[model samples]
Target chain A: MTSSIHPTVRLTSQQRLEGIWNKRTYTIVRLIGEGARGSIYLARIGNRYVALKISQDSSVISAEVNVLKEFKKVQGPPLGPLLLDVDDAYISHDLKLAFYVMEYIDGVPVSDWVKREGLSWLFPISFQLLKKLHKIHQLGYIYGDLKPDNILIDRKTKQARLVDVGGVTALGRAIREYTTWFDRGYWRLGDRRADVTYDLFAFAVCLLSLDPHVTIHNTKERDIYKVLNQAKSLKPLTPILKKALSGQYNNALELKSELGVINRKQLQPTKSNRKTATNPKIDFWPEALGLSSIILVHAGLFYFLFYRI
Target chain B: MHTGTIRQILLITDGCSNQGEDPIKVSSMIAQKGIAVNVIGVLDDDQTEEPVGLSEVNDIANSGNGISRIVYADVLSETVQTVTRQAMTQTIQGFVSKELSQIFGQETNEEDLPPETRGEVQKVVEDLGETVNLQVLILVDTSASMQHKMEAVKDAIDDFILSLQARTGDHYYSIYQFPARNQVVKELLPWTNDGKRVNKVFPKLAAGGITPTGAALKQTVKAFQNVPSSEEWRDDSDDIIDSSYGSSY
Candidate 1:
């Protein structure tokens, strides 16, 4: 029986991988990210480094590879890591693992970026992420697992990019992967069906999760709403998020437009309101107004990205 | 892509079968009818030694032509969804592999295909996986050893059904537990799409009985055939479960 095979592939430090199918060789650098389905390793294919995902289940490798392929067909900005290679390798005499290599984006996850840069970045980051989600949703797929780990912020350009398409399910199909915190079913708010709204719902949760104060317990609907409402950093966008969480927006486009309106509305008040900002009673308002100038630039970028698609 | 529906019997248990018939044999018979019998061997977190039923779980899956997983109770819901999706893709790959054999005039597995062709085949398989009608018969081992694990089992089933709503394919789910008070198997909830029906039945689930896995599996095969109640199981199936429970939310 194959029961004794380890759930994950553990290799010696700087292990070398020679593919059986493609006759390609790669040297491992280190483990990058580990998911429920597989562990991703940063590896050197030749002189260049690529992200390699190895799994015991060949179908998982195949499904994700296909998603990356689908990403290439989308007409806009790159959706995820580029698919480079797909092959199988022998870990032991009896154990063969299916692996696919992709172009590695050297960036921090969005959560880390938000923590480092502060709450103002949330608007621009969400704008970029919603654009990507809208593109994929147009192809009748939902980014089923839309947590922060799956979205990476480029170190130099500070642009948001999506990674890990393992949970990309067809819009109507059962969601194959999800995190408990981002899942609407776990919150007892909505069903787990893959749809445009499902990703939007998760997008709302993903945004909420950036706030260090917001933690969702596995019980009570009113308590979750209370916690989300009380978050100071997320207060301005709370109404938009609430609409998304309640499945008010029909598609990512509708959600994107609503978000665009908020950014614009946030921008209008900044110029006139800057003079009276030093008052102790309105300290929070000044900080919120400060984010508007950044939101204006991002709002323009959002339009460029929107029509170029 | 295979156009017909995919049928699966997901058997979840923590220990070995103690009475009635050989589960491996029953699984093989079920496999012969083109229904895969996937098994998940649930284990408690602190347990050290391997459970007695671990090998039996592998044997059943092997003979039944399905995937088998042994996971801790904490991750049961995730494993349940993964195994189900894996089984669907595996089944489709199997058919695609056979068709490839005819075209190439040699035995060729889908994985053995060149990477480009494999990607195309995988896309087809994934598309088919979404659209193909799926019917899963969930078999839970409700022996005394599994008493503490019932909460995890209940959550897993609920999660599984809720997850299925994302699929475009029509799904029919039914729950069957082994070793009812008198009989080998009892129907907790008949085939239904509403996951809420499971909430009603878990309250009635009392875990104190022998593990008649083989007999339970035999009854599962009969249930898949749409046989209402065979003579021996008819009397006990009526006592606790109301017929209305299957169809109602």
Candidate 2:
């Protein structure tokens, strides 16, 4: 409608782009990904590698740039791709394309990591992700589109890092972008407004999507309960997942605490017998109290047997 | 009443208007009434030549103070959702800019402001977008050339309504078809929050008529003005639907 603003033209390897404002030059290395908004290229400036996203719409580019900048203001483990530069580049004499450069994360999507390493990596990564999401929520923003495609398992830190800042909307705006499978509205659970509950719901849907036994087909007529029932390895998380899907949690931190409980409950068998001895149904304080009492009784017996004798 | 509601008329057409008044003029008038008019040109894949009516789509949207998109039938659903949300954000941003100018005595876009203040303004815009009530009037061109595209149009509207269901604010949607049986426009579905209600109306749509887009849009201006309040709809929704159905056909 606006005369096709250079998104249709694919940049070849070694194509150079210079920022109209910053005047920095970047050499296109290869295309990393492409979505409805634009194409992301792995580009080189000097020896540094950065991911550059080029789009026809200036507003889309600006929105994402602002989110990335906002992400920097929040103190936490890096929640998303680091914003490096924002500018417009002329591809031809007449055509101007909006682009932004960010730190290129070399990691596989969390779903792929799950497929490769097994389901054990699921809960830990999920916990870590929720921690990141909580920090984001504290800043009054929603990771509007929280799906496996946008989350990457950082190869170096082994932490789950969000990649696409495009959907990082300030809390309360309508969700900017979303995949239907991860959207609660599509499942008839909630609206698409950017809120903590919105992200939590999508996070639960994302977890459901990663399970090997669960298949999320593109259908508007899906029963979320039925889909949750189909999960095998993620079955233990079903309760927490339901809580999120039903918009039960107040914030990501609350959901994180609950997910922590489930994660610990799931890992109890692999832990020491003392931890396994603790009842899974009980609260954390009760578990701590039970362990302390066990320690205290053992200490009293050892002192009486050794020192009193 | 505290939240300023954003009203929109989203028109989906596949061809040029061949009947009645000029759609561009009608859209300009609609924009003057503070209602944004967005247009989507649904192009079939087989059409290799520059699709007809693309310029009208752009002109209508531009003069109507909204955005226009030309998308193929396959991706119509995604485009519809994006265009609607983007237009809502733009409308809110326009208001935010006006407020900024009044406060600072300097005209500034959000992007031009420093990061700290910009972030604060953006937050306000986001909150307003979520809290504001929304009413979308969907106008579809059911000309003979658009018969094959009717399915895609229906799916797009269905998805659009589904997307709206996720918002915090109240949403009401109504559907209009141009060139109905012996009329310029027909009310296919009255303003309702239920997305499933479209199912009953979509199947009955026979896409064969002259494209009287201008007349249809003119009728929509009246529809918007006479929209029954939520209370009124709750009282006699069935009657409204029955009467509209009887009159249109």
Interface RMSD for each predicted structure: 2.8, 4.2
User: Tens-digit lDDT track for model 2 on A226-301?
Assistant: 8888776666788888898899999888888887777666632222223323333323332345678898999999
Per-residue lDDT tens digits of candidate 1, residues A101-214?
998899998878766555556666777788898889888889998898889988866778888897898876778788767778766787877878889888998888777656
Candidate 1's DockQ is 0.37
User: Relative to the true structure, how large is the alpha-carbon lDDT of every model?
Assistant: 0.77, 0.76
Q: How far out, in Å, is residue A306 in model 2?
A: 24
Docking class of 2: incorrect
Clashes of 2: 2
- The sequence of per-residue lDDT tens digits that candidate 1 reaches over residues B142-244 is 8898999999899888888887876777788899888788788889988888877989989878887688888889888777666222221232221111223
lDDT of residue A209 for candidate 2: 86
Which stretches in model 2 have alpha-carbon errors above 4 Å?
Answer: A1-12, A95-98, A218-220, A253-309, B1-7, B13-36, B41-66, B70-77, B89-135, B142-172, B189-215, B218-249
Q: Which 10-residue window in model 2 chain A sums to the lowest lDDT?
A: A267-276
